[model samples]
Target: MAVSLLCCDWLKEYKTRHRVGIQIRGTVESISKRFFTEVPCVGQVLGDSFAEIKSLGMPEHFCEDELLFILNTDKRKSLTLKYYARKILYFLRQQNILRSLKTFLEQPEEQQSALEGAVLVDQYCNPLADVTLEGISVQLDEMVEKVKKTLRLKNPSHPSLRCAQGFFSSKAMSIPISLSVLYMTLSHKLGLHLEPVNFPNHFLLRWCQRPRGEGNEKSYQLLRDSLDLYLTINPDNVQYLLLQARLYFHLGIWPEKVLDILQHIQALDPSQHGAVGYLVQHTLEHIQHKKHPVTPDEKRRSAPEHVEVQYSVGLIMKHKRSGYNCVIYGWDPKCTMSQEWITTMRVQQLSKGANQPFYNVLVQDGTCRYAAQENLEPHSAPLEIGHPEVGRYFSEFVETHYVANEELEMRYPEDTRETLGKVHELYHGLSLDSGHQDQASNQPNHTTNM
Candidate 1:
């Protein structure tokens, strides 16, 4: 996954409070208010109409014409009241607006009274008597650009870009939730109709209107029927779904909702068991931790480790080719082609003074096997190296030629001493190397077999 293992801490905390039916009406109301009053002037325009829609309980008695009038009044010309009216009409049909209002009113009296305190005004009062589609489109385009510019400034290191980098560099999968949020915000500002798909463990956004249709004349009707068509087709574009999931997850969507999104993702890509498994495990871990106290060790053990290894190994390999690093492999009896093997690589560099040697070491496991490239000509490992056992044997040969006088105790530290010892224990007992050494030397210097 492109997601960082570093997010475990945050996810854990999120899981704890992400209980079902955790009402966030107050928070939503607060955001709605700020979005109207403190955000760009466009928000103020949309907020005003929305505020009226809320106050009147989105009356079933109110028709489209009246809503259009409220939106395009003399005070709200710049507001694109028709767009807001269309959105409100869509929400009413979807039952999202009325449902929200009902939920709000059903809350405790203090909560209900709190929402009522916010005043609704003609914040978008447009002096113009009539609005045209062309005008609305032009205004929406400008607003969309403004929102994009604002968000770029607000979150310079956006999560989507980060996720993309993660994918290219480490093969990690990250849900680009923030990017989806940006898309939604921009789409809303631009008056571009869209809908969020709640996929299992992910989210996706779809343009309500198709990019093309049977003909230009049919386009308007197609646009009007877009939502219904989308609901019927139920697109499952993986990339779009993942983006949506990330957005919802970042917005602190309920786990059930997140899972619903992810299930759809799983259905599309069954091999994505790793990602799905992590979601389920981590979410359960969150629930468990909340229900009871967990020790530091328990928490640590529950953390997802796959991406960490991938990231670390990727970093090590990036610098390995400069002859500035070396890898040491320790033998494990249980090791097999399917089992991951650990290798420690050290990056060599000079410290402040020439006399000070510095080494930054990373120990990790890689699924890529050295033997996988055996079919290639002049097949050789990039470093002309193998396990530490091979290095130790080569060291013995070096000792015979150049360091006979130097005692092993004087030259090797404890850790190195142990490594060399293991090498001797494994290979010294076998006479195969002793007998085949010359024969192997006589053969052409082809690739060393793993």
Candidate 2:
């Protein structure tokens, strides 16, 4: 197809340019430093990553910057996330994967920079195993075309496409925020010096076009002015603002902080009063359960004295009775829900009853369940749970388990290490079994001795 040819040509040109040792833009070090210093929200999202970024100061590909960012932010020690990150970059360097960003790249460089400003949220929301840069580009292009068609139909006189509104209204159809992050990365490959702007309710990128030979202060001022003007002209809707606050909560920002924002929105628009109250109540419950959790020790006695918590966080478990896949994000020493709900679910029917440990799980069916320990089992062949809330509590999906994110770690600090140990032990046991079978097969028949 013509699209494939375009992809090949674009990749060839990009690789040729890369091989020439042309420093199109400054190293990722400088870019990351500038982003950290100028963009306070970025620093907030990725806490204390300055030291990590400083260590990786050498000039490298744009993808390396994102990989490092994801690794640092997630704080995942598992090799699975690293392996997949390396795999993506390897294919990029080897030109094994097609560059499907040809159309976006071919657009006017100015417009490309604008697109970067509109979709910089991708930095925090990194790509997953199923998310590919090429796939995102194709989707982004299709969305743009759709938006352009709508604009032409609605207002033919002024058909200037709005990047933020279009992409915001049109869902990515893949992993939630994959397209946004990949869009920023794809533009970075084109040598655009786009800096992330801390726009209200969203992350925006601004093209940093410094006076040919000037210091950062001047460019910073220009960016500030542009951001100010942009804000003044384009205001966010109340509904969008509420959604953004919810998004911040989902991304593991402080519950009190998000709640404050929601309350403020409610104050500004009385229409959202009821919705904000419900969200406030929901967030308060989340804070009580996760942020200031009562450890198993505090609940009854030390974990040794009371019922030993069988399952740790970040475990992929199958419901023995319900027959559905789920991943654990939290657990209580015993059932902590209301007695009414317990009676309704018939918790008394279980062998251990409501006294057994209960797990808070994100189910594949997009529902949250508090399953009893007796009803859960380790998945025989664990795969990633396709749940929308996976990003809220966990960061990386290891081979058979999920790696808890910082917020989840705050609640269950020991779980991440335990999950890693369990994974290693599982593989070690498998290898031992294989070795025994190999030895048995290698032994020759001693017919002469017999």
TM-score of each: 0.20, 0.40
Residue 295 Cα positional deviation in candidate 1, in Å, after optimal superposition: 34
| Model 1 bad stretches (over 4 Å) | 1-31, 34-66, 75-87, 90-231, 234-240, 243-259, 266-270, 273-450
List model 1 lDDT by residue over 1-450, tens digit each. 546766568765554334210222222222322222121111112223344445544334334435444445543122222333444443343343333434544567644432121110000111122333456557756876686577688976665434431133212335557667788999999999777754334465767653321112222222223322232234566555555444334433234545766688899988877776767566555445434633211111113531111111101122333322223221111112222221222111222221221222211221112211111111112232212112111222221111111222222222344434433443443446766887888889979879
Per-residue lDDT of model 2, residues 240-277, tens digit only = 56765665555443466577678778777988888788
Model 1: per-residue Cα lDDT at residue 221: 23
Candidate 2: lDDT over CA atoms?
A: 0.57
**Model 2 stretches with alpha carbons more than 4 Å out:** 1-302, 424-427, 447-450
Q: How many backbone clashes does candidate 1 have?
A: 31
